[model samples]
Structures are given as C-alpha cells and as structure tokens.
Target: MGASDTAVAMSTKDSSEASLGATAAGPTPAAGTAALAIAQARVSQTDLTGLTLSGRYLVTRKVGQGGMGAVYEATHTLIGKRVAVKVLLEKYAQREAIVKRLKQEAQLASSIGNEHIIDITDFGNTDDGRTFVVMEFLEGESLAECLARETKLAEQRILRVGAQVASALAAAHAKGVVHRDIKPENVFLLKRKDQDFVKVVDFGISKSLRQSSEEEEAVRLTQTGMVLGTPLYMSPEQARGDEDLDHRVDVYALGIIMYEAASGRVPFSGANYLSVISQVLNEEPKPLRDIRPELSEEFEAIVAKAIAKNRNDRYASATEMLDDLNAVIEDPTHSTERAKITGPRRLLPKAPKIPRIAWAIGGAGIAVAAVTIIVALLMGSKAKKQLKNANANPPAARADAGVATVAPPDAGEMVPAVETIKLTIVTDPPGADIFREEELVGKSPQTVEFVKNNKEVNVTAQLPGMEGTTSINPLERKDGAEVKIRLKKLKGPPKVIIKKTGETGPQKQQGGTTSHTGGELGTNPFAGSGTVH
Candidate 1:
C-alpha cells in the first residue's frame, strides 16, 4: 500500500470462528455484496476465499487491505492452524522495487527475535507470480481501535503497554533494525495470561541501521528526496526528508503516541499533510499537566525527553527511557531527580538564534552556560554594593562627622537588574487562562513581564467554553509588543473534520507518497490517525 496506510488489522466481526479446524468454514460474505465491499475499499478488490496459497495455507476471507496489498485470514490446510497472509496486488508484482520492499518487510521483521514482535514464518511467490508473507494471526484490536472505543486507557494500562513497546524496540534496535513507522495502530495489543500483551506489527518502511557489506547497495529503497512514514508521527529528521535516520525516530514516535494516549489528542494536528508537518517541525506539544494536571512530573519529563527536537537530547536508546518509565510506574511519587543527567525535567525551549552548541561539546556545556549567565549577573552584587557605598559617603561626608547625609540606596537598587519588557496578553473573550511557553503565566487581560533573554516563546489562550489558540513571539526582540488572540465560542457539538490530503494534487507529489491508500482512502476513518489496515 502507500506509506500512510501500510498496515494490517485483525478480524473485527468474528473471533469464535478461529476455533474451527481445517475442515470447517467461517461465515461467508452475503452473496453479491462480497465484491462490492471489497471494491468499496477502492483497491482491485477480490474475494480470495477458498483459494489456497503456497499449496499449504487456505485463504478463508479478506481481513484488511492497504496501498499495495491485501491481507487475508487463512488456515493451514494440513495442520488446521490459522495465520494472516499479506498478498501483493497483482499489478505491483512485476515492479521490482515494490516486490523487493514487500519481501524486505518480511525478512526484516523475522530477523528481530523479540517476543513482542509479530512472528513471520513463511514468505514466497504464488502460482500467479504475486508475492505473499504469512504471519501469526492476532486475536485482538489494534491500538487505534482500542483508543477509538476507549478514548483513554487507565494509567496502569498505559504503563504496561508502554513498557512492552520499549522492551520490543530495544530488541529491534539491538539487531540494527529501526521500525521507522511506530504509532498506536502499529502497536497491537491482546490478552496474554490475563495481562495485556503487545505485538508490534508493520515493518514495511523500516530501515536496517546496520547493514551487511553485500546488502548495502541493494537495500536503499528511499530516494534522495522521498519522505516515508505517516506525517503525524514521523520524527523531525524524517519530516525534513533527511537521509541519515536511526532508532531515535522510533523513540520520538513512541513519545507522541504516549502523549496522545494520555491527553486524548496529538500535540500537533491540522487540516492536511502539510499543516501537520509544519506543526511537528516547529511547534512544541502542549504540556501534559495543561490538559491533565494530575499527571506526575516524572511522566512529563520522560515524554519531553523522548520527543526533543534534537535527537541527541532524546533518550540514547529505548532501554534508557524504559528505566525511567518503569520507575514512575512503581511509585508515582518517586523523585525523578534525573534532571542532573538529562539536563532538566522539561522540554527545551525553541532553538536559539545562536546555533545550539554541537553535542560534541556535550549537554554539560549547555547547563554550565545557562547557570553561568545568571550567576555572572547576581554574583557581582557585593562589589557593586561596595562601589555604591564609596559613592554615597563622599570622603567629605566622612570628614565632617556631624553633617547630615542622604540615606544609602537600597541593596536591591545597587545591582543593575536584567532588563525586562512587558507583554500584555489578551484574548477576545478576556477571561481565558494564558500559558507562556508551557508555563501558566496568568489569566488573559493581564500584563506579564518577560526578561530580554533573546529566546522565542509561545503563548496560549484557553477557556472551558472557548477554543484555544497559540501565538509565537520573539521575546528577545526587546519591544514590549502586545499579543492579542481571538477565541471562538463553542455553540453546540464540536465538529470533527477529517481532512484528506489526496484531492490536493500538488501536495501529493511534493509529499512523495505521503499516504498509501494511494490517496484512495476516501472514507477510511483512521486516515490521519496512523494506518490501521
């Protein structure tokens, strides 16, 4: 399929049929409607029921479909065991690039020997020249469906799912594999021994960070300017179409998914592909406490690190992230005094005008620079006070001991304070709460003072009955400009607009296969929320 819809989903209608043995059959689709339902998907739909593949597994029914292929539920004709089969579209069979990509998806997935990774047991060409890969059939819903059905999961459930995902990524990274497309839908969850068990699926666009000498030239499917993976969850590097990518992309995506799980919305969302990408590269997601103040500082800090704009600022590896996540799970009150190690327990502000010193200089430089600037200003107060005293008592006043003298200026006045500029933040409604750079500064219609720190900051206006909006300001400009934002009053039911990027012809080409349904995903509800078959 396309990059956006390159995923598979489990059977939604019936799971009991799985109990049937080899000789048994599942419910058959109503007579003529079979073709219509498949066709409605906008693919070269075909009812593959009753067809046997590789002379071993029998295709029972079509389970799901994607950009370049269709997934079918099948059974082992001889052993009676069930499996999921992904078949390349007949038209794409002749294209070497498409064929190689599908084959590689299977090979790379099979290489990672993690219990949480879906098991790929068979891959080969069919009698008609089409390719197929058979995998273990899962029995539960995708994380996408689970979220739709239950908008938010309990904290414990989230922790369990998160831990398993991190564990799986660690194994994948250790094998030099990067699941370039990690999102809620790519994460499959079902019950295992009375507890939630996770099985990460869809490795269609994954890359091998560590490739063998012989396979190097043949495996570069992504061209110089091509951008793969869903725009909503791709890392900043991936969004920019950068050539060099590694495991950190998955780490970044995992944080996005976790943030969505906790807040019921993504940090960045918009009307189309370009809009969402712009936010991802330039905007910071809302803070967890802003939406759910009950969240622990540890959680906020952990997620902040995962999605940091600079890859070096994120956790060095999935293993490192899991360590902190597991701690928060054990005891929410645990002091995540890890700021000493990760720099601070919060998201770094926007990139500064001066280039971020290379990590080659280490984060310690940043910490020292930040600490040095403040200390340099306040530490000289003693000398400034001594000079003031010398100026106040002119040797003449000391000479004439009886002379009245003016009172010495207060100590606070002795030290020259950092220059400050006042920014009057006002919303149309006038009563909304304002947050400047993720911190609750004050209510709208209020004037807040900002130091001339030469850094960029974004201010937001939000209220219960009104829609929120954010504006970015160059707080360093030293101009005390007033920021005014307008809030829309909520009238009735909030509208849910699912913007499709397909109709925009120019963007599709510029986006380079932004989504897989071949832009034919006309009514797929999960269009922008990550591929769910």
Candidate 2:
C-alpha cells in the first residue's frame, strides 16, 4: 500500500490514449499470494446486492473494500452519470458514528474546488443505517493500476502527473487540510474522451484543522492498531503517530510517489510492512538517478526536496512544489548546466585578445598590435581584389579612381542587425515575450536591425499563462519616432464583444480582429510569409 509494486508495468503499456468510460482489466494476483494477501484479507461480508439510494443512485456492484470502507459503482437516474459511492460497513456505522465523520469528509473535500481533487457531492445514510459518500465516477485507472501496467513513465508524462497532483495538494493545503494518505492508489488518472485528468481520492483519513477537538472528535473513527496509511509513503512523524503532522507529510509522500513513477521502484522496501516502516524511519533510500541515470538532475533534486526527512527542508506548500515541477518540465535544462554552452550565447567565437574599442584607448604598445591585426586583414582583402582586378584587366593603368565609392554606411550598422521592432508586450500583469506582425517572435524588447529600411515591422511580446500583444506597422522611421506600445495582460482569451463605447472584454485590443483558441486570444489574422523588421 505504501510502496507500489505495479510500477514495473508502466514502461511496457500501450502508448495509445484510452477513451472515456474505458476500463482495462489488468492481471490479478492469485488469491493467496503475498501480493494479494492484504487485499483478500480486507474483503468484506457485507452484501450490497440490490441496495438503492435516493431512488436514483443504483448500487451496481462492489468495486473494492479496504480498511476504511467499501466502494461501489452506481448510476444516477436523471443524468445517467456513473458514480462511485463509498459506504461504511455495518461494523463502522453501528451508531451513526461513521456517518458524521463521512459527512465531514464530504464537506472538507467539497471546499476544495480543484479539479484534480475528487469531487464529493452528496453524503447520507441508507435505510439500513449504512453511511455512504457519493463521488464523481472515474473512468480511468488508479496510479497504482497504471503502475501495475507500466512501472515507469516517460519524463514528460511523469512531470504532467506530478504537476497536477501538486496542484491538488496545493488546493487541499490552502484549505487547512492534509491528505494523510497520499499514495498511488489514492491518485486516480482519469482519461476523458480526448485528455486525461488527475483526481485524488480517499480523504477518509484526512486531517482538518477546522474540525473541533471535542471528546467525540478527538477519538478517531478508525480502529486502533489498524495502520492508517501505506507504510512506505508515510512521513517519519506520521509513522511515529505524531498528532501534529501537517502538510509536510503529504510533501514527503508526493516525493515518494514521483520517485517511483520515474524509476519504477520505491526509495525503500523490506521483507514486510514493519521492516519497511523501520527503514523509512532509519534509512535514506538511494537517489533516483542511481537507478535511472538518464533522469534529469533537476527532477532528482525536486524529489529529494519533497522527501527530505526534516519537514522544514521540504517545500512550504504544495503550490511551491507544483511550480518547481512545472519549471522542470518547461525547461529541463534548468536542473543542471553542462560543460557545453547552449542557446544564443553559443554563436560567438573565442574571445578577442583585446576589446573592440581597445585601439581607440589602449597605449601605443597595444595600439600598434591592434593596428597590425587590422592591417593584415586589409592586406588580405586587397590581395583578393587585386587578383580579381588583374584577371578583369591585363594591367591596371594607374587608375585615377582607385575604388568604387558608395554612400555612407547606414545607422542600422551601428546597432545589432537583429533589432526587433519595439513593441510593448502588455499583460494584465506586464511580462516579456518576442512577437512580430501580430505573430509570435522568439524574444522580447527586441530590435530588427539587419533588415533593409521601409520594411514592414510587426512586433509582439508573449508571456506564459498570459495573453500576448502584437503590432504590425512599417519600420520606416526617419530619425526616432518612438513606437510606444501599451500591452495589457488579458484575463481570458481575446473576445470580440462589440461594446457601444466603453464596454470591456477579456482582451482590450485597440485594433485588429479577435478570435480564441485554447483559451488564448490573438489579434489580426494569420499573415502570409514575409519578413518583419
């Protein structure tokens, strides 16, 4: 339960995306095998056949039963939506004891509006006095199930799951809740028709600071001696039964889960649950990169931080952890710098012996050296030209006009030829991005210098998770008529709501047509291929 064994299967699973309501039947362990022992032992005698609730949610069948409760797949009468409802067995619901706690679980989980966290819409008791919690019907497999099919995922996919779970944890943590049980089984990876969604489940053992510590509430509903969480994912404090554990426990668990997802192995394992707990407390698991050397150092670092033994060493909140994961995904190189240089900086050659302006200011000694270097370059050019001139003419009658003359060099030469048209990248919160002619460029605050004069200049700036602004105009300035652009960050995609005069839309575009794609706004239609200064 704490450390997953199914992760070994993730690597070999089919790559094609599954569809909504799709269920892949994985191989099941023999009933008496060690792997299936705990699951089999927990099977309940409670019969849910023909049980109906609210005259609508029809109990289909028992999906699984565990130490906490029994889960069932049911159908909603009106919407015909399939949902899973967890019901407390008769033993736990003897006196409406578990009913109140399950209600609290629903309330606490409902407060968390994050999509990654499971949605609990209704909670009630049946005519037979059994308490039940109705949650969204998940069509996808649990992380454990997926891991069982394939232990390790590609780096990109792992990052996607990590980012999503982090967001779920963040939402839960912000509401003063801690999901004491954070493991692969509790993290469901649901696939819609076109995309996958992450939903965290099983908050039955969750800790909420908002709940009162009265005598009734002080006594936990779970039976004593029944270890609440999977041992491998439990933090040291949690394993020690420390009542003061906070969100840090979840941090440690998230790290363990991510580590396993990447390497298909847990950081720590033992012959039995007790030994595993002992090792978790006394030993540090080997680094993930040790198992998969190809793993990014930055990713390893993030896992290390999340699994830090000391709570203080872990990220302060789930959002912080999520941000780190997103950063790692967005820029894999951020984790480490290689001996080789990359990006635009690599274009330059070895450094010059003296700076460019050295000839102007250096003393006579260095000046002579610089002059010699320049003269050598000139001599080489002269030789080439002389060869051409000799070929063109038999002998140069000492020419009165030695060389062709051209107009003075353009001012554009003094500046970088890559001068991008100046356009302010306005954001709701200002940010930087490169854009041209209402199209995305690669840099911000850029200048297009190398281009010839009178060329059309389209400049734009783009910021991630925000709207981008672009301007298209000819860059035929005489001296310096500054093109002042004011870009505003749009709250949503650029919308075209024709307001009489002062009605505001998500985008405040001064000019150009508007359209939306993927929750983003774009002004101006796509332009034909042409160079923009």
Candidate 3:
C-alpha cells in the first residue's frame, strides 16, 4: 500500500493468488480496474465437503483457496489414495468457455512431463456441474507460507528453488505452454529425496502456443479485454497487454520470484492493482543489490537481464536462465561478474607528467620526497591529537634501528589534491617529550604527519635531568624511515651562568653541542650561525 519498493504479500492462507489485468485484448483503464477487482474477489464461498465427485473420489475438507477456485483434499473411493482436487466455482464451471480453458490447463500441465510440475492425474465434471482437476496431494506448504514463516530463504535454497522452477518452466516452454502467472504463492515446496523440492502450480491463466488438438485450435483460451496474471509478477509486456507475449514473460516473473526470495520483498508494490501495473509498465525495479548488497554481482546481473525492459534483452527462454542458475549451483565461484570487470583500470586522474631526465636522475628520491611531504602535512593537522604527556610511550632502547612502514598512495589510485608524509619519533632511554616545529606533540615513539610543504621542520626530544636532542633529519628520505634521538644524562643540575653585559655568542658545552639556556634541549647546530664564509 505504500509504494513500489514496499512489498505487500498476499494472504498466506490462499493456495494460489492470481491477478488479472489487460490481456492481449488491448485493455482500457476501466478493464484493468475491473479485472483486478474480480481477481481479488476470487475467494471460495461454497463448501463442498462430504460430496462424492464423479462417483469415484470422495470430497473432504477444503485445503486452500485462491484467485480462481478452491483446492480440496479428496480420496479415491476404490484406491483409498489421497489427492488434491482443484475445482472451479459453480458460476465459472457452468460457463462452457471457462470450463474449456480449465480443461486446457490440465492438458498443458500434464503434457509438460516435468517432475517439478504438479502431476495432473484426471480432469472431470461432476453431476452437479462442478469441474475439477486432481493431482498429487502435496504435504508441504506453498512458498508464500514458507516466506511468511521464515521471511527470506537461505542463499543455496534460493538457488535450488530457482533451478527447479526454471527446469519446470523450461519443460513447459518446450511443450509450447507459457505459464503467465508465476509467483511465490504458486510454487509449492516440500521435502523430496531429503532436499527442498519445488512443484509449480496454478496454470489457470497459462497460454498454449501450439494448437495440438481441434478443441484448442477452435476455441482460444485467453479472453479479450481481460488481462490475467499476478500483478506483483507481471512482465512489462504482459502489463501492457501485448498480444505476442512469449516464454520470456515466464523468465521475467521467475526472476522477480528469485529477487523476492533473496530480499524477502518484491521490487514493486502499490495500494491497488492498477498502480502496480502502472509501475510494471513504467518503472524500473530497484537493482537486486540495492536491497541485498551481499548477493553476488553475477547473480544480480542474471536477474537484471531476466527482467530487462526489452524482451530480447531477457533470457532467450527459461532454459537459458536455468543454465546460469545451474552453473552457480554447481560451482559457487562460477560467475559472469568477473568478466564484466576484467582487465586493469585507473580510478583516479593521471599523475603529472615527469620529465625523462628527472626519472633518470632521481626518480626514487622524487617519490620519497612526495610521500614525506604528504606525511608532514597530514601530521601537522593531527598535531593536536598527539598526546602531550612526556611519558606517553615509554621508549625502550633497541639494538637495531626501529623500522616503520609508510604507505604511499597506491598505484593507479588517485592521489589526493594535497600530498602528505609521516615521521615516526622514537628516542633512546624512553619517555622523552617530543616537539615538532616547536609545538608539543606526544612523547617519543610517536608518529606525526602533515602536508608535505617544502618548509623545513625541526624535531626536539626532552627528558628531565638529561640533555635533550634536536635535529632536522632531511627534506625527505625513502618511504620507510625513522627519526631516532639519543639523550645524555645531565652532568648535574643546570649551572646558572651569568653573561657579561657585552657577551653575545652562545656558550658552547664541553661536548660541542650547545644546550638551550632553559635546560630543555639544544637547538639545531645551524641556528644563529651567520656568515661562515
């Protein structure tokens, strides 16, 4: 009742629910509305329990009812075997035309000779003029019931059910019988051979392509101005009342069923039948992956093709669709999606053109420089996040240089508009506070990143009662690099040396490195040293 994406399931109590709209006989708006109304009102009102049919089978309680009629469980008096008897209501049974069509349905289904199809054993009219077709009494419930209980079928079960339905449909198509109505409600599921087995039912609106008999040739079953099939599963062509509908219609409907099984809902729905039909004719269904992204791309593609707007775009027939389903069932990895994306592709803008001379001279150096710059810029932005606590990462001295891996932009991966680099700060004797560009970052053993501008950045490490170290390593180095700092124990507490009034130059320490006057860390040796030449 909401919109196309909202699925409104039919009543699970119905064994077979069908929707009738415009048929090959071009339909007017009124006809579409009227047909849907009639289809919706197909509930059985009369109870025929305890009646003997054709003096052969004794009618029992009604099992389920649907758009066309009610199905009853009955037993043959002589054989004492139970069977399902589908009987037309008196109003429809008395109509010679409707009766002939029902008989044709039995003939068409029986002729298919597929095990997945319901087995129609007999078709006869009783003394009361009630027409019925008897078939094997299935002990399991319809797919509608299963979905109502479970919501969505498992993946393998979906494929299994789809394969079986396709097999049945292939057989029907080969026999020139096109099942115009295929939906969850019409598919019966039961345990057979210890596996989930499917039996396709409800051939009331089926159309036979071949005229194998005089009765079939003389009286066409499909009526004029009366389109028939379930609105939820109708193909676009069928919704349009196209006169030349073919087996692909069944293929499309089956795809919808499979889609429903995977997503637990139909792609289209509406408040009334006409609205649904309108969507079928005018709207494209949401992609199968949109609702359930985990579904394999290959599987989604198969369903997408089945429901293509153009009939030719769909599977040639149910057999063709069955082949793909079988392949998936046989080998889980078998898929067409890989072929769709085969070969290399670039996901970003092309890198700037580098001159041949530059590559010949220092290509690796240039690449490293770019990565470092990128890392530096990134670290600059994240500077505030770095823990300022001096002892954040208690550094442990290592016998060998600690190595850290820096990931550069992937090959063919688009480079961001801005490049960045990262520098890992690790110090010996641990717990030293680190400062980048004179700003407090986390303690040693931390990594800092920022945009790689050409400007030089100075790094400093500090520890109490020890001489801190500061160094400007390089503009850039090859991808994986580390900045290791070694701090020395202070000789004693700071010596407050008073400078003479005219003294200006820095007072050099005994070791050659000059410590800052504040007793934190020494500045870079190059600082304030002017005009060496």
Candidate 4:
C-alpha cells in the first residue's frame, strides 16, 4: 500500500488491529542494524557561538544537534529578542540538494504565523557557506520537561495541552503544512498566570504543498540510508518508507503523544527501532484506562479516537480532536459518551486529590506596578489647566501643585435606595472557616454583601487540617443581587484513601467523627506518587 493509505488504515482501525513485527512471516535484520546505521552518520559538532548570521543575530548556546544540522539559541543585537537558529554543518552545506530542502523547511514554517506552531523569522547562510534558519525562542519548558517534572500530568491539564497542540496542527494543515515530527520534545509548554500554553516546534522535517505534485509524490527528503525521526513517534506509513504521506501521519503521531501525556507511557515500545516501527503498523495500544484507570471516560474515548488504527475511525482533522477536548472541558458530566461507544462502566477510578501549592508568587511586585501606573495617571491629570471663559465662577482648585480636589457630587442628597444583596458560601461539608482573597473572613453557610459600585471581590473558605481552599468570584454578582457560590474543595495533601464502608479512611475530622471525604488530603510533594489513584 502507498504511504497515505497505510497511514489512514493504521489510524482508523478500532481495537482489533494485530501485532506486526515478531509474528509477521518476514525476515528481520540483525539486532543492532538500526543503531549501527544511526551511529555511522555522525557529523563533527561545532560551537554555535562561532557562527554569525543575519548581521544582528549572535548564536549563543546549542539546544540540539542532529544528523543534518545543529540548533542554537541566538539573540538579535538590536532588538535584544531571542530566537533559535538551526545551522547546517559545513560538510553537508556544500550539497545543493540538501541546502535546497533545508531552505524549504524555513520557508514553509515561516508561511504559517500561527501561535501554536513555532514562529520562523528568517533564513540565510554565512560567508563560510554554513546555512542557518532563524526561529522564535520559546521561554518555557518543553512538554517532555513538564511530563518529567510532574511525572504524569493532571487529566484536565493533559486535555488542555492536547487541545492547544491540536489547534496548531489544524492551522498548519490548513496551510498545507504537515508536521512529520510530533513528540513531547518538540512541544513547548508556556507557563502563564492562570494556565499553561502549548506551542509545536521543529517543523524542519515537515512537508509542505509548495513543492510540485510530482516531487511530492516520489521525492524522499532523507539522505541515503538515514533514519529521519525519533522511532517512538513515527507513524506506520513513515516507518514503512512509503512516499505518498499526508496529514493522517501527523494524526497518528499526535495520538502517541496524547497517549504518553495521559498515561506516562508510550503506546508502542520495543527493544529496537524496527520493532517499534512494526508495532506501529500492527499493534493496538493498551487501552488508556488500562494504563491510567483514574482518567475520565470522556478522555479515554478521546484517546481511543486519536489512536484508532484506521484513519476513518479517528478524527478527520486536529480540529476535531480539539473539539472533543473542549467539549470535555465545557461539561465534565458528558463523560458518559464513552460508554455508548465502548462498554458500560469504565468508571475512571477516583483520582487521589493532590494538594496544589498556594502559588501566590510576586503578587506584591505586580500590585506595586499597578499602583505606580495609577498614581502616575492621577498626577498627570492634575497638571492640566481648566477652561473657564464663559462661566467665570469656577470652583477653587487645590493648593497642592499636581493635585486637584473636587467636591463630591450631590453629597446632600439621600442615599439612593440602599439596596441589599446576599452572598452565601456553600461547601461540601456545611461549615468551614471562610476567607476573602486569602484573608480569613467568616464561616461557610454565611451570607455577606458588597455595596453597589464595587467592581470586584474575592471570597475564600478554609477548614482546619485541610490544605484545600475554596474561592468565589464576587465580580460575577451584580449590585443589589444575591449570589450563591458552591466551592469545590481543593485537594489538600495525599493522605486521603478509599474505604469499603461509610466511614472515612485514616484521617480524622474536626468533630472527631473521623470522616475525611470533605477534608483536605496529604502532601504529594514533587509529584512522587506516580499515578493519582
């Protein structure tokens, strides 16, 4: 079968796909052939800082090195902006064919300016004939780093990460760009205030439609007898060396990434590259539930769809994967949709609640900056002169230079119908100490109110011996209206456990009943507990 057909077939099949490598009646190569071949293609490593490109970009530290080229972190002298530059070595730089393909990589990536895909700025070669491509420098860690740091990500966070990557892939596909290499190392996780953002990098091995149809059909970009990509992520068609590859290959690769992100394990792992390649062709990944039983059913179905062995059974595009992910986020209750497609009762074992650290880092710095800006604006307005020609009787100005004072409007008038609003905090347990913006307030099941004209307010609840804190967004409430908030208990530490009866586990409650269900768990510092359950 052709590459595209093989890729489609592998991606669309359900769980019935058979194993390919060891059972197939084919002659396999020597055990170390793949590694031996990889070892022979070594090019001498050179310092990236030695090369000067684009006049202003100075290469700094080396980020990665591959068979074809090496990547370096570079900074623009004038703008002080950082970027990643991939430099083809001097030995391969003289080959016109390789140089042409390398240039195409930069052009294709540059054509798509979407935020999910790595941003490419420019490409050029130096006087010494070493070619380099300039790309944006991502500030945060790679998905690989994140996975390693957390070991395994939270179910919601994994879905969020997948959705972002899917959006990037959709944009690239719309522009006829297919990311041939989609792995954790190539995926960047940018940290923000509320959540993490994802970006796909390294389109160097990607294929684009800019090439002629004839070239696209038969041209193999890899050098003679060279392995192009990481074995774990290669799609079946890519492993089989078929030339008619397309977007479906990317889908298959993304499936593997999602699998790893959710379960902390690759779907197909073998002793060698060929075995891994064969498994991609014939094997079915162990169901996600089997690996991480605590993951939600909706997420399992999403993983199943992405990992389908037939292209038709899987999502038609990355956009479709993103849609499913967003649907789960919008309604976690819709998880039952998986039971309809699969079997009944794949209840993801309840995930052990892990305490999220109270990360109130540098709040003071941000507050100070905001206050400075507001003070500066107030001072600036005070210097403006008032116009009073026709109306000569103007109000007296303040004696302070740069400061102006005005009398309150209608102070003598009666307070306009003082309206009363009620704000109530609802906790799982009926009563817990309440707080507002981290400051202790009252107890739960209590009502409070803000006067009209208050723009925003925060309400929090805390229980003794519980690491969890519940907060409410008082800004959502309108003036003179009641607001009811149901605060979901935050995970405390990792001390909570399941029991067969109605009684709680080892932890004790405040009233001495020893019921710990609604209370905080224990500490899981560094995410040492591999699986949540």
- Cα RMSD (angstroms) for every candidate in the order listed: 19.7, 22.0, 26.8, 25.0
Instruction: Give the C-alpha miss distance for residue 500 in model 3, angstroms.
Output: 84
Put the candidates in TM-score order, highest first. Answer: 1, 2, 3, 4
* Tens digit of per-residue lDDT, candidate 4, span 1-533: 33333433444341122224323644345323433433332211246463456578877788878778888998898989988888887778887667766777788877877888878888887645678888888788998988888778888788778888888889889999888888999899887775788888877677785678765533345667645567798876677776667777777777788889888888789998778888877665665666777987667666765665545435678887777777666444555453122211212223222212222235553464345435534554242122112113435533443322222223343123333333333343446554444334345444344333334445544455543343334344422111223335455643232333543222221111111212111100111111111
Give the per-residue lDDT of model 2 (tens digit) for 73-159: 998878898888988877778755456667767987999899998999998876556788999878778999899899898876787
Per-model TM-score on C-alpha atoms: 0.56, 0.55, 0.54, 0.53
lDDT of model 4 at position 13: 40
* Candidate 3 global Cα RMSD: 26.8
lDDT of each: 0.65, 0.60, 0.64, 0.59
TM-score of 1: 0.56
Q: Taking the tens digit of each residue's C-alpha lDDT, what string does model 1 give over 1-533?
A: 32112211122112223334212654344423443433433332344566677778888989998878888999998999999999888878787767777788899899998999999989987655788899999999889898898887766577778888999999999999998999998999988787789999988778887776456435455455457788778898998877788899998999888888888888889999889889887666665656787865556656766886657546889998777667657544455442222211222232212212222234444564445334544666574455446446645533333433324444443333344444445565566766655455556554455545646555666687675555444343322223556678778643332224443211121101111111110110111211111
Count of residue pairs whose backbone atoms collide, per candidate? 3, 28, 23, 18
Q: Candidate 3: where is the Cα deviation over 4 Å?
A: 1-46, 212-224, 330-533
True-structure RMSD for candidate 1? 19.7
Tens-place lDDT per residue, model 3, 1-533, is 22211211232222122223244445556565554544443422266576677777888889977656778999999999999899887678667767877887798889899999999999897554678899989998889899888888777678889999999999999988999999998899999787789999877768888755565433444456557788899998888878788899999999888888888988789999899999887566665655787876556656765775556546777887787777656444555342231111111332333211112134454565456445544675353123212113424534353422223334454323444444445565556766655455566554455344556556666688654555443344211123556677778873233444553533332112112212111101111111110
Better of 2 and 3 by TM-score: 2
2 against 3, candidate with superior lDDT: 3
